[model samples]
Target: MELTFLGTGAGRPSRLRNVTSAALKLPAPSLSVWLFDAGEGTQHRLLQTPIKLNRIDRIFITHLHGDHVFGLPGLLSTRAYDGGVGPVTIYGPAGLQQMVECLFQLSGTYIGYDIQYVEAVEGVIFDDGNYRVEAAALEHRIPCFGYRVIESPRPGRLDAGKLKEAGVPFGPLYGKLKAGEDITLPDGREIKSSDVTGACIPGRIVTILGDTKPCANAVRLAEHADLLVHEATFAAGLEEKAELYGHSTTVQAAEAAKRAGARKLVMTHFSSRYELEDAVQLVDEARAIFPQTEAAFDGAVFDIPCQC
Candidate 1:
């Protein structure tokens, strides 16, 4: 899995950053990508990267802010033009369905593929075979939500030596045994999978939050995450402004990561006033509290290692 920051600016676009958008790349059975917060110019940003628009299967929007949702209609229309055929599911707060419908009506745009819009509350919003996504309400001005993407634990690997010792021949039965099933030997003796398998490898957890202030919900959502992507819209000395604007400062985001026991902290959603050079200082401010902290910029990609 990997995370690519499409736009890292907050509120508006700047020369250094665009807006709030990101792509989570899941490299497994197929090259699947999930987009989070498709801000303005998100399709344009995706064009600049190696991401294919047709491969995006899911989109998660945090709120109804223009900076976070204005690019949806355009992206949907462009995907239709680009020959996208599969269904796409979008999860967001209440009113998302109405908002998309209104945009399509106003623009007279028609999509060719099936687009499923899900109005999400504070609970498990999506669950596939590999991952479970849960949302929690955050303290934002527009009922924003934070998402936790938890990967399911993988089955244990098969021990080839043990399998050979158990007289299990190399065939489809070996596949079944690797899948945690018992296999009967030629002599009718049953061999349990646990006896010939290694320890089950745990999956990684990634938590990404939308625009919000420093709240307990954010901390709880990010607890024990391998990667915590939180918005840091201000510098360290702007705590009062952060609270007033329903956003978090660099220090506050880092403090949340520290409190939640997150292994790594990635701060984005920076205000346009700060330049790219200023991001180093912002990262330093966050790292002062959480040692493994970094600031994300447009086009930045983190290649997460697979646990299995």
Candidate 2:
């Protein structure tokens, strides 16, 4: 899977960044896109990337803040205009359906595709066997949530050479062995699945959080995640202000990643006060605590490898 940032600024748009939005592009078999938050100009940002609005089958909103959801109505409308007929599922806090319906009613807009709304709840919100998404409440000014996307573990590749050496015929029996089933040969010998198969490759875990203060839920959602996207809305010196505004400072974000044992940390939702050049200092402060930290900007992309 690959993660693309549409907007990274906090509260409002800046010259270098927009607001808060990110997209996760899933690989083959389920070649679809999942969007996390849709701030203003989110559709415009999608237009710049290769992802189509139709490919976005699921959208998870973190909160009802203007910076997190102001562009949702526009994005849904444009998806219809762009000939997106596939069903779309949106997950968000309470009043999400009412808010969107109210906007559509006032604007006299119509959607051509089917839209499903799932009110945000603290637990496993979605599980399709292949992937599971868990949501947890976050410490923000208002209601906010953090999501953890976990991919299912995949079976290891079958060893055809080892099977051949073991006098097993290369046919449907190999398929059964690959499926973790024991097979009995015509010679009255039994072969275990683990005898030829390699170790299972573990799945990847990604945690994406909304604007939040340093809290336990944030660490819990990000625990041992392959990639953790957390908000660093302020620099180190502005810790008090960040906490007051229900946001995390650069140092605080890195500390969360460290506490959670996250493999990599990508900090977004930066304060507009920091210009492009100032990002170096902000990320440097974070890197002081957690070395595997990066500051996200608009159009930034991070590819999560599938292998364990």
Candidate 3:
């Protein structure tokens, strides 16, 4: 799994950064990409890279802010034009469905693929055999949500040596034994898979939050996450302004990661006032509290290493 930051700026676009948008690509567990937020110009950013719009299976909108969702209609339209054949699911707060429909209806636009809208609330919004996604309400000025994507734990590797020692020959029965099933050998002895298999390998957990101030929900969702993607819309000393604007400062985001015991902190949504050269200071401030902290810019791609 990897994350590509399409836009990492706050409030508006700037020469150095664009608005907030990110792509989480899963090549193993799933052969598709999920977009965190489709801010304005996100499609254009994707155009620069090899990530095709037709491969995006889902788009999660954080809030109704123009910077977060202004490009939704355009992206959806482009996906259809780019040969997106399957249904595309979108999860967001209320009014998301209305906004998409209104734009297409007013413009007399038609799409070839089906669009499924799920109104995000504080609970598990999606669950498949591969992963489970939970949403928590955040402390933004409007109703915003944070998502926790947890990949399902995998079975332990098959122990061929142990199986061989137990007189289980290399045959179709080996598949059943690896699946934790009991099998009778040619000698009429039952062999249990627990005797040969190791412990299950845990999956990865990624927490991505919408624009919000320092809140308990953020910590709850990010608890022990492999990667926590939070917003730092201002420098450390600008806490007052950041709070007033429903945003978080560098230290505050780091503190949230620290409290949550997150393994890594990738901060984004930086204020346009700060230049790329200022990223070191911002990262230094966050690292003072959480050593694994890093600042992300447009086109920054983070490959989440396997824990097992």
Every model's TM-score: 0.96, 0.94, 0.94
lDDT of 1 by residue, 148-249 (tens): 998887779999998888888899988888777888988999999889998877888899999999899899999999999999999999999999999999
Say which candidate scores most in TM-score.
Answer: 1
Candidate 1 achieves a global lDDT of 0.91
How much is the lDDT of residue 42 in candidate 1? 96
lDDT of 1 at 173: 88
After superposition, candidate 2 runs with Cα above 4 Å error: 166-192
| Residue-by-residue lDDT tens digits, candidate 3, 1-308 | 89999999988999889899999998663778999998899999998778988779888998999999998899998888866378899999999999999999999999998899999999999998788999999998999999999988776777888987888888888888766688898889999877878777788899999999999999999999999999999999999999899999999999999999999999999998899999999999999999999999999999887676
* Better TM-score candidate (1, 3): 1
Error of 3 at 123 (Å): 1.0
Among these predicted structures, which one has the highest lDDT? 2
**Cα lDDT, all candidates:** 0.91, 0.94, 0.91
Tens digits of per-residue lDDT for model 2, 213-302: 999999999999999999999999898999899999999999999999999999999888989899899989999999999999899999
Where model 3 places Cα greater than 4 Å from the true spot, the runs are 169-191
> Clashes in each model (backbone N, CA, C under 3 Å)?
0, 0, 0
